[model samples]
Target: MQLIRAFLVALMLCAPAAARDLDGIRQSGQLIVCANKNAMPISGIGDRPGFQMEIAQEIAKELGVRLSVEWIWAGYQARYTDCDLMLGVARDPKPASFLRYLQALTDVQVILVFAGPPRDVAFEDLSDKVVAVPSASLAHFKLLEIGADPRVAYKSEVAILQAIESGELDAGVVSSVALDWYRHDRPGAALFALSTDILDVTSHYPLTIALRHTDALDEADYHEIAAKMRDDGRLQAILARYGQTLSAEFDNPYARVPDEISEPDSVSVRKDIVEELEDLARRNREELEQSAK
Candidate 1:
């Protein structure tokens, strides 16, 4: 009897963590999401809710679980959190670090210029020009690398655009996603004005949904659900607002992942990066003209 008791205790001690499956989530009735704080247009803090939060809410609705967000900056210890999901995660393979990626969410790119500029503002062409850049953004680094004159710093992408509109800055560089949010919210903004000039430089990359698996067991089934959404074009609709349409190739990194686990989707593989932004701007302009009637 003592030997049997010892065996049972060992079995209990050796038990593995649980996998987040359909039935498990149904029983819990809650899906906790972890998101980076202040990532505007994706995940925001305080009053402004990012679109990724909306995406998480929709995922919870699909899973029949109540949605909740656990906000954290980069270095939050995962051992202390109960977060089961995350959205808009950059596809990095450096280290799993206790997280599993389910599927690619959308593409991300930097848009250098908006409409109304007299000339195209390329990085090599910034002589005698005042360019507004969101502090610490990819564009900011690139501007410095090219030795741009008078690089004005702004707190946020929205602030950069506002400075341009207020005539405090001649032009600004911002991410396509934030610009998409701005055009959607303020469709009547001064894109129709003649001052918005074109700046040169554009690129894109993929963003994925990161999963904090409760278990190390392969999550093929959970991934299938996200794949279903991608195949049905539902995900495309969400990304299209920001001029991001998923690549038709669907080069899924989650499948057949090797042991190395590096930034598989490292560089922005997008070819027609600026064209997508222009198309969005053109469509919005036409809609604005119609609404003016």
Candidate 2:
């Protein structure tokens, strides 16, 4: 028994991860997706169909497999579990363990008001007006910074919309992606009368779709999915359903380049400029030296 235990320990020390690749998962006829079970508009296993679930379904269709979700809580395995893809994660270190650069998902922080927007309404303009912000969200912090009297409410986007319709909150904030679903389930022209796109969120975060290093997909693939959704009028229709346009970042993706692409280009361009400047400086120095001689 002791010898067997020692051998197992040696094996564990030798090989930590087994090979879980795309071809094998595809052959199994299921694309196992790891998703947040409670996050709204993004993903959750409930009444409101999540956008991440829709994305997963599309990917499964693209790969010719069935979609299966593996709901995760605090700690299990985002990588080694019954999941090959993790959806709707923020730009954080949690997905850094995986080996892929996610250049797709568009995210932004903005606030919406239930009433018809006043021309050029500012934070001070909302000071006297009752406003509701999602607790602990970027909007909540922004509202606090602006010193607006904010009433923090539901964490769910749909619930937030319901609260707005029920005259509970004068205004509320949520991820634009989640708003897509809200606009769909509830149809009303007066629901979203104001979108505070002018909000400054230079330090805001974005949601991402993370995949294993060996996974067979790229940013272009996701783009194609979005393009199809747009062409078929499914995605845009959902946005219009709420009288809300796409968030600034998503209205045009190229407006915000991915760090993976932009970082390298910036480095290369700066290197070229530095090299040219150095050569010019050297030539000028040589000319001055010859003149002194």
Candidate 3:
């Protein structure tokens, strides 16, 4: 009788453990989050916490899980693969092979910075001056479209701003939110906004959560939740707390380059580029083999 009573007590303890919801995650008890440190207002390493970190914490709280942040360097390719989810990513409906999920939170503005006598200058007037831009960024492509010299390109916004400040570059392009932060911190430096609007005023690319392709979460799930948050003012409240706002409609010139310039048609343009590159590589390899023979 004593043995049977002990067995029953053991089963009761095991049953609750077996039926526990979120066992998969609770076992870990931590949701790993990857963030780009340079993504200002969205994510950055500074005294003030970024908006992305705030939103991510909220999500983790809802999940009843702890948030564990892993900081990635400036380049996107190096650190995207190490985490369960990424914050402040631009939305890509058909993402890269490894990216399974993307849901945008806000659109960011891209603006031009120049040390000038006036508050603004037109884009057409920038033809002759050296315009520094971050490599692989929307600003770089925009500068290229307008025939700006590629030699002036820098790898990060920090470099671009440094070049502009030191008079090495005539102008630099940066996110407006970051610019506001910089201005607030440094009242003496006179950084003026350029009047020349070469591109349409765009929103920051839809900053989203990027997850692995094999993750359980899907786009629909993310969208439904995100849209609800947006609708109920949850997202707005979050942004407002960080001194920012959720974009009403996507229109940040610095975020994603327009479809007209780099169309997202998977079956058409990008496919052709990929194939052409592959063909070129194959031809080069064949030539090397023939030489070896």
Candidate 4:
């Protein structure tokens, strides 16, 4: 009997701890989120709490709970932290089996950015242009596949944008999230994002929140919250504050939205080498309209 007792204790010790469900979270009066301390404009501990924090705050408000953040330094550190929510999680075709994804908050796509006036630049047109792409990125590989011979010279989105702004390169392809933050930081700069409507790349994905699979919240529950936020314009307002927006595919649920775009398993360049945190300022409406001009 002692041996059996010892075995049972060992089993209990090895088992993972149970996460607090919705009711438990409400009872605790706090919605805990794991956020990166250095991923600025997304999550951080600077003057601006970052959009991820802002969105998580709204979620906590919806749940009628206060917000509690546990800051980590990188994405890999999330595994070591205990939290109820993770924001800005990229939606994958083959999602992690242990987690349940909420309705996506916004779409992130590869965009072609350059200085000067905006003009429609087709994917085919980039064949002869000198462009800076993040090293070994989906856009980098695509440029090579199309014989563009893009300069794989930059390690971060900010570097690529800086090169373009200085006229060192004709243009650069970066994730839309980077473009949004860059434009926000440099509102007076002439740099603009040119539409790459024809680019068939795997760098596009939707950003969503994820929680470990639990009985507390089902997919329908998640979707209802997202739809409510979307219908009430809260979701759009959050992105707008950071100079970001949803892609056409996942922009509005009430509208005739297209199907979700499938993305590769590979990760994109998300972390910036130099993190900048400023007040959450709204980009002018005309500037956004001029981006597509």
Per residue, candidate 3 scores C-alpha lDDT tens digits across 107-162 of: 55577788745554666666677886656556667667778764444655655666
Top candidate (lDDT): 4
> Ten residues in a row with the worst lDDT in model 2?
11-20
Q: For each candidate, give its TM-score against the true structure.
A: 0.60, 0.57, 0.60, 0.63
lDDT of 2 by residue, 1-293 (tens): 68855654443333213324667767899878777776666677666446656666776787788988877752234533657677765544323344443444555445465644345566556655556665565556767776676776555566766776777777766556655556665545356534665444323355555665444455455556666765676654544543334334443433443443223323455446544655655665576578789
- Order the numbered candidates by lDDT, best leading: 4, 3, 1, 2
lDDT by residue (tens digit), candidate 4, 157-270: 767888898988888887788778878888877887855555565445667677755453455665677678778998788777778775454533332112354433343333
Worst 10 residues of 1 by lDDT: 192-201
Q: After superposition, how far is residue 173 of candidate 2 from its true place, in Å?
A: 1.5
Clash tally for model 1 = 6
Report the CA-based lDDT of candidate 3 relative to the real structure.
0.59
Question: How does each model score on lDDT?
Answer: 0.59, 0.57, 0.59, 0.67
